[model samples]
Target: MILESFDRRTIANLEAALERVCDGRPDGADHELRSFIADAMVACAKKGQTTLGALTEAGEAALARRGISDRKQA
Candidate 1:
């Protein structure tokens, strides 16, 4: 599996990116957003962009492409 190819910290970066973006959202309400970040992170890893910064940026960019902002509007 793709995950088996990644180190713990690298995978943690993916989770960290999600938590950062999805913070304060109700449970079960972030499925779509979570998937987007996960997919983007994997795609980045597959393309050899495995740095934490690169992966996090990729996740954020993916959300932006979907019109999902980094922080929820007040």
Candidate 2:
């Protein structure tokens, strides 16, 4: 399971980043966005980005690449 693979702190950081990137989505649990967040977190963690700020930046960048603006939906 994902929980077994990563520590709680890492998971928390990723979750926070995911929330930021998913701010405008109809559903925070959207599969594609979740996948993107997971991928970005993994990539950033591998590069030693364990901090929330770094992970958030990475997540935001990933969203931007997919043309998913990180803003609240109307």
Candidate 3:
């Protein structure tokens, strides 16, 4: 998917948003989760969710739909 060209500030914000849920676990072991997040971001962007908050919410909702929890439970 062709994602929108966001400004540096927006890009930084989105990356930070993704990191909150991904937690720096995008190595080989967490490839699937990484892919899910990437795809979700694309989906959100396609739907005009360019803001960090919107993308984050879309990513979480997408993962939740697939029963994949990004939260860390105590």
Instruction: List per-prediction Cα lDDT, in the order shown.
Output: 0.75, 0.79, 0.67
lDDT of 2 at 6: 73
> Where in model 1 is the C-alpha error above 4 Å?
24-29, 68-74
For every model in order, what is the number of clashing pairs? Answer: 0, 0, 0
Best by TM-score: 2
Positional deviation of residue 22's Cα in model 2 after best superposition, in angstroms:
0.6
Task: Name the lDDT of candidate 1.
Answer: 0.75
For residue 9, give model 3's deviation from the true position in Å.
4.1
- lDDT (Cα, tens digit) per residue for candidate 2, span 1-74: 66776789988988888787788878657897789777987789778887889988898788776664555442
lDDT of 3: 0.67
lDDT score, candidate 2, position 2: 65
TM-score of 1: 0.69
Better of 1 and 2 by lDDT: 2
Instruction: Note the residue pairs that clash in candidate 3.
Output: none
